[model samples]
Target: MAVFSVIKLSELEGAKRIDAEYYDPEYLEVKQKLLKKKFVYFKNLVKEIIHPKEIKREYEEEKQDYLFLLAQNVRPLMFDLSEKKFISEEKAKLMPKNLLEKGDILFVRSGNVGDLTVYTGEPKKIIASSDLLIAKPTFKFSYYLGVFLTTNYGQKILIRGIYSGLQPHIAPSYIKTIPIPILPEEIIRRTEILYLKAQNLLKQSESLYSQAESLLLEELGLKDFKPRYKKTYTAKLSDTFSAYRIDAEYFQPVYEEILSTVSKKHRIEFLKKIFDFRRGIFISTDYYTEEKTSRPYIRIKELTGKTGIDESKIIYIKDNYPIDEANSLQENDIVIAIIGDTIGKTNRIYKELSGGFCSNNTGRLRIKKELNKEIIPEYAEILFQSVIIQSQIEKKKTQTGQPKISDKEIKSILIPILPLSTQQQIASLVQKSHETRKKAKELLEIAKKAIEIAIEKNEKEALDYISKSEEK
Candidate 1:
């Protein structure tokens, strides 16, 4: 079956877009419905839309002079502040217009096109990378517009304007022409309230994780410690020969500093002692499929910590791919990235991801029943994410074309054994963090759904839906 749309010659001339995608029937239907309701052009709703001037990669410095926001920093519907890059104040002064203000909408103009999020994170001074488009809306309308753009209706229209090629791109000019429905004041207020609540929860989640990390460092007497990086270090020839490594980075004083600190604080044990480890099965690409199947194939990118698994991003394999219980994920299992730049990145398998299939490039750690009394899975996960174990993992990584750490190397990394009471305390904080994040995600979903309802039905119906959802 084929879908067709009839466009007037004058309209076609005005658009100047002869591509078939521009006239897609589904896109036209959505546009017509939105136009039927009270609406205004997207450009009118914003104070300004601007993209950053290209800054040479060499200009970026490690010093925390000013924060730079890149396309990769903006994930779908959320801001990832895990990685930080900086530029000098002198350079930032040269580009005054690129500065990001709180609540400014950061939109990606290229690669992972249409990925947008509100800049609700900390630090007053932030700048956008060249590939991002900054949309500064007036007053409280930022949250409302952000939620609207993330909805299915908004995504369809925004994506429709994209020009596909080697790399799909959405020009700022296209974004300016998008139609935004002028929803009722009550609906906008409700949406803003939900969005604000979600943002607050996200902040609480960050605070709780910070507390957990602080507790771990405090327990190890490393709360105020900083590793000294030396230009040169000496090591015994016999030690190098025994380890079969001669790389300078392998002998970095910081690695030794971290290890020595942990060794002096508490008794250290290899990860293998507390858990049984296994690698995921290697299924060839031929077996992968986008169609629905029995299980979701978990990849390294899907190992998002605490945010839980994103069901929408999960791709499927053929039902007859011969999956077995051994290859499937289980609750409380820890999946660690064993290859690429994210080597050592770990995420605990939650109930929602149970029974999913893991990719071959990952390793799974399950607590040994007998060792449960000494170490809990949740506490171990927190330890894995901490800088102490991460430094060790970095030391053991092979620096071939792509970095990788063997499962054996991962199992050999030392884990400090804390008292059961302390473990429980840290584990409790991590669990609370996960819960708060989950609630935040739920509120975002409600906000998105409410917009969809308002557009598809009416304001009254959407308000009723929100009321019923809150009551439940």
Candidate 2:
């Protein structure tokens, strides 16, 4: 017989395993109940459409722009397709691909696999890249299928089968075989409604972000700005000026084009006086503690996936902890992720932080005392997320085999110095957008909770809770 030691709840530390082992039969029972209550469905691949077996070895030399369902581009799917460059027909034809239809569930097969998204907008022509799987669900329940695929039930089974080693991957055949929860008809209907609202909210968020960018560009009279180009075909050029010579990835002219537009349009002198750009207080892991308090510390991992700082997920330090210079995150201070993959991304603290401590990966900027200044932290936050700044950072970044942007590049970034009125106007719109986004997030949380409750109880109870919350 197996033996186990029991320990009190006090012995457990922040979800970590302690030396004192304990067995919980209730935990397994709950898990089994949830599993038993769950239903499983599979993707229906039966169709009359021709499935291409032969991988085209060569594509034509002519370049034709088409919608690509690549994983990187799918997260923020609202792209100006006309403005984006495309692969030459020769390069495009070599990969295994399929036509992407509206409402088709897009799943990443390799490289940070299991990133799920649904194609909503109607596109004339779209091709699924080799790394993507286009789950063409029947029109009758395509939306419902997409929702199920992204939910906890679908994701749990889908991710469990990944035979990951050096790199994680989920083959299309394996993904298609995974069981999907066959939710009740009434529950599915309610889910579809919530899902559609969520979709609308997502589109609104994207639209608002675009509006914010356009307002910034228009206020500075860069609406029709076009970047300059030297040689379009510099692939064969030899590097005589530098020690390193490689592919055209490093010398991509898009950066120069983005930089020139900002420099020529915005007044550089005015920007330097408006806001004080400061690096964050460098912190180490040694400062962290198991004890929780009123104060919350912000980390890079917490801010990466979302648009702003999530206060709920903030880690708190002990109240009596020493007040180091790095531990202070004041109100209106802009936080930017300064290390690893998300270097240029920026977020602002909207409310006063209770014992605000910032992580080393986050750069904090304290706004100048002048509240009515031409450039505020909010304005700076929006500008930092603009294409102009993104392009500039990309150009100056010294790729250590991979793209890596540094804090030096972030601080040196130039901003458009516009009239105080224009800056405030843009800030106001961004604020409203943020508010709407917050509500949308609440709705998404409700959706998740409703699904969980529905699995344990019934659809009526979950819907009642959602309705009450909305009413409040």
Tens-digit per-residue lDDT, 1-472, candidate 1: 5767787878783766988889888888888888998999888878888988888863454656788888867766676655668888888888888888877888888867767888765656787888899888874678888889888888889888898778888887888888898899999999888888888898788789889889988997788887778898898899889878898888788987887887897999888897788897777787888786766677787765545454546767787777678778888888888998788878888877777777888888888889878887778888888878889988999999999988778888888999999999999998998899888888888988998999898889999988887787
lDDT of 2: 0.59
- Each prediction's Cα lDDT score? 0.82, 0.59
> Candidate 2, after superposition: displacement of residue 311 in Å?
9.5
Q: Positional deviation of 472 in candidate 2, in angstroms?
A: 4.2
- Candidate 1: the clashing residue pairs are none
Cα lDDT tens digits for candidate 2, 246-352:
64655777665665666676666433355565555644555556555656688774563225665434666665666765457777777777666766666777674
Per candidate, the number of residue pairs that clash is 0, 2
Per-prediction TM-score to the true structure, in the order listed = 0.88, 0.70
List candidate 1 stretches off by more than 4 Å. 1-29, 57-65, 86-88, 120-123, 138-140, 161-168, 281-294, 306-312, 316-321
